[model samples]
Each structure stands twice: as structure tokens, then as C-alpha cells.
Target: MKATEMRSDCPISSSLDIFGDKWSLLIVRDLMLHKSRTYGDFTKSAEKIATNILANRLQLLEDNGIIIKLPYPGNKVKGLYRLSPKGVDLIPALIEIALWGGRNISNTYDGSPFLKEVKKSKTKFLKKVMDDLLEEETNIG
Candidate 1:
């Protein structure tokens, strides 16, 4: 469904309704940045999302058309989830959030490389991510 058709009353509320959950965004981040595709990969995240929560978020993301599951070529019972175009669109927002956190939040691990890339050329960073996503999707397919 189109974004226009998704909600009419309050855009923010509608968006939040779709992506308000913390796990959902983290799943998206993993898919976007780490190219994580399986349940095992998500469970291995630094945040250590619970198994049941991860399952629910994956289902929700699939239901929302933000991700699609493709079967593992050699094994029909196994499959992998990858971002759809709608999901890939969240990259800019993620970049902004990462940059903001890197700037204001104090953390031991320096995110300077990512921050510098984002600051120097947002367009380039976005393009690179888009390319990477496309490449990943192609490989999966």
C-alpha cells in the first residue's frame, strides 16, 4: 500500500505505528549495514534481541512490505530476509541518527570513519549503501 493510503489522520502516528518498535529499527540496521539475513545473525547482534522478539519483528517487517523472504536455493526449508525498496529508503534516517549519536553521545568506540563519511558526503554515502543493498539482493537472488 502507498504511504498515502497507509494513514491519513496523523502521519507521525502512522509512521510510528509501522516502525515504533525498537527491535524493528535494529533489524533494519542489521539488514542495511551488516547485511544480516538469518535468524542466527539477528540473534548475534550486540543488543542481543530475544529470539521471540526477533521472530515477531521479522514477521512484522515482512507484513509491512519493508522486507521479503527468499528461499535458500539449496534448501527449500531455509530462507533469508532482505530489504525492499521501502526499507532501503530508511538509510538516510539511519545515517542521520548515527551521526547525531556519534556527535553528542560519548562512547569508547570511535565512529569517526562513518561520521566522517556521512559529514563529508551524504550523497556518496547513500549511493554506496544503495549499491551495496542492490549487490546483496542480487547475490541473494
Candidate 2:
């Protein structure tokens, strides 16, 4: 939304104001898994987010400086989306959420491998993931 529209000065609330939607974090998750993704790629996600909602989330994320939209190579009608550094910073939080879900949710999808990596050494896992993302952004630039 906007700075003036935030529900409170609470950090959590403020952050949510920017990305408190069902699909925004999913979009962020996809970018975490790849250097860049196209609109078409997002549409193909298992979540099957609607085109209108996807379009809106993309715009909202870009507006909030959480993602960067770039011209897709040799494509006039598509754009590549990747997380901005701010978005990358959310990885730790996402990991925590994943950990919680894995432990508390019933019938959660198999994510043992990743969870094991984090449980084995959260520091190392975060460092590698964040470093990889930083490298990807640098290379893109």
C-alpha cells in the first residue's frame, strides 16, 4: 500500500503491509529458487495463482522495492522478475516459516532435505543461499 496506510509502526505490521498477501511471498519463494523468472514461469507454478492476482502482486512488489523487473532477453512481451536485496533479506524469515510448517502442519509436502540442511547448520545454509543470491544479482547487473 503506502507509508501513510500502514496499520501501525510495528515492524511486523509494516512489513506485512508491503507483502501480506497469499501470492506475494510465493512469488518471492520462486525467485529464491532461481536467478530470474518470467511472468509465464510464475503462471505455471503449482499454486496456480490467477493472472490478475499475479499481475497485481508483481506490481505491488516492484512498487515496494522488493523485486526488480527486467527486460527478458529477446522478448518484447515478457519481463524477468528477481528479488531485490530487500527481498533476499526475507530468506531467514521464510526458512523459519518453513521449519514451523514442517513441524506443525499435517501432511506437509516432503521438505526433509532442505529442513535437514537448515537443522544441521542454519548459519551455513543461510550464508550459502544469501551469497548465491548476491552473486546472481551482481552477475545480472
Candidate 3:
């Protein structure tokens, strides 16, 4: 569904309106897991997202309050992106998706020992990721 069109009032539909595209969640994943900040960092993802699509997804995410664009003191030309609390809250979901893929999908990651802990305790992992995201936000903001 298009961003402007509300398919339904369902929470899932609402979320999909903003991030159901191929690239948005990957952008989030990068920020949440890899500490990506600059446009250059996103463009460098292994999936090789197109510059135009990456730009579109970044704007959409920022508009939806899933992420915030921060000023980069080191580089005036490039913007820095960080997860808001709402975005940070998606960590558990990401962990679930990763665990599902790792279990059902072929050749997926075994993840790290930390990830094993995440699988056992999603709440704990969520808190950890949230804490880290907020700390990054504090340092940057």
C-alpha cells in the first residue's frame, strides 16, 4: 500500500504503510546492529541498495518517526541517522525474525553467543538494544 493511503486501521497495516518496502527495514537493521550513521554507511550495506531507493527509504523512515536525522559535526554534507525509541523497540522483532530465519531458512546465521542469549530472552535483548540506541542518541544529540 502507498504511504498516503490507509489500507486499514490495523497496527500491522499502519506499520507496513511506512516500512513494508524492500529497503526500509534493512536500513533500520543497519542502524540497530551495525551502528551505521552516514548516508555512505547505508550505501555500503552488503545488499547494495540503490542510492535513489536508499534516499527515499531514509526520508520515509524519518517522516514516520522510526528514526531521526542528526547533524554530523565531522561532515556537513552527509546526514546521520539514528533510531528513535520507537525504532529501538523493534529490536525484539528483529531478533525474532533473525531467529526464525536462522531456524527455518537454509544457511542463515548461527549468530553470536550473544544472539543465543537473545533467542532465550528477547526482553533482555530488547532492553540492551534500546539502552545502546538511547546512549548513542544521547552522545549524538
Candidate 4:
């Protein structure tokens, strides 16, 4: 299903419809942090996502314009997935969620380098993330 065809009654629901699943957001997190681009990269994550589920989530992300698949420069048969502008815009939301979890939830994912960077300089970190994402998008295009 396409994002355009999703319900519009509640904005939150609309977003949830597209990215409600645990694995999908995790995939986005991996892209945002680890710069994981290939299917193998995602499948080999610590969460150990199943192969079929990973494939489905990747397709969903691509269909929703959250990511774009580009041919690996050296290998036409293999492609790398990178965040689209729409996906990059999600960084602030992800950061906020991570901050909330760190504050309120015990035993949260503890080793996030990005979260540490945000803790040091939130404004600068966010700006840098946007700049980097924009640069990547420009290069890809």
C-alpha cells in the first residue's frame, strides 16, 4: 500500500500506518546511525531481523519515499539504501524519542554515539545531521 492511500483523519495515525512497526523504525535508526545501506547490513543487526521481514520493511520504506535505493557504484546488481529528504526529516523525532527513553526508561539502548553527541551539543548536532543528510542527498541525486 502507498502512503498516499493511507487514512487522513489523524496525523499520528497516518504516520503510524506507515511506520508503526518495531522493525521499520529500527531500520531507520540503523540508517541514521550506522549508515547501513545493504540488506545484509540490516539483517545482521543486533536485533537479528528475519530475512523476509527485512525485505518487506525495506520495500515499504522505499515505497513511502523514506529511502531510495541506488545501484552500488561498483556493483550494478547490488544497491545501497539511503534516506530520502522525507526520511532525514525524521531525525528530530527520533532524537526526541531517544532522549525521552533515556530519561524515563531504565535499561534503554545505552551505546548510542549519536545520543551522546546530542547530549553534548543538541543544536549543533541536529544542524550537522541536517547538513550531512542534505549533502548525501545532493550527491545521490
Please give the CA lDDT of all the candidate structures.
Answer: 0.80, 0.85, 0.80, 0.82
lDDT of 4: 0.82
lDDT of 1 by residue, 1-141 (tens): 233245556867777788887889888888887654777888988999999888888888888888888886787776788889999998888888787777788872455566677788999988987898899888875
How do the residues 36-72 of candidate 2 rate in per-residue lDDT, one tens digit apiece? 8999999999999999999989988998888999887
For every model shown, what is its TM-score relative to the native structure?
Answer: 0.84, 0.89, 0.87, 0.88
Tens-place lDDT digits, model 4, residues 16-126: 888988888888888887543788888778999999899999999999999888887788778888888888888888888888998889888667787788888878888
Name the runs in model 3 displaced over 4 angstroms.
1-3, 112-114
TM-score of 3: 0.87
TM-score of 2: 0.89
Q: List runs of model 4 lying over 4 Å from the truth.
A: 1-8, 109-111
Those runs of model 2 whose alpha carbons end farther than 4 Å from true positions after fitting are: 1-4
Cα deviation of 75, candidate 2, in Å: 2.3
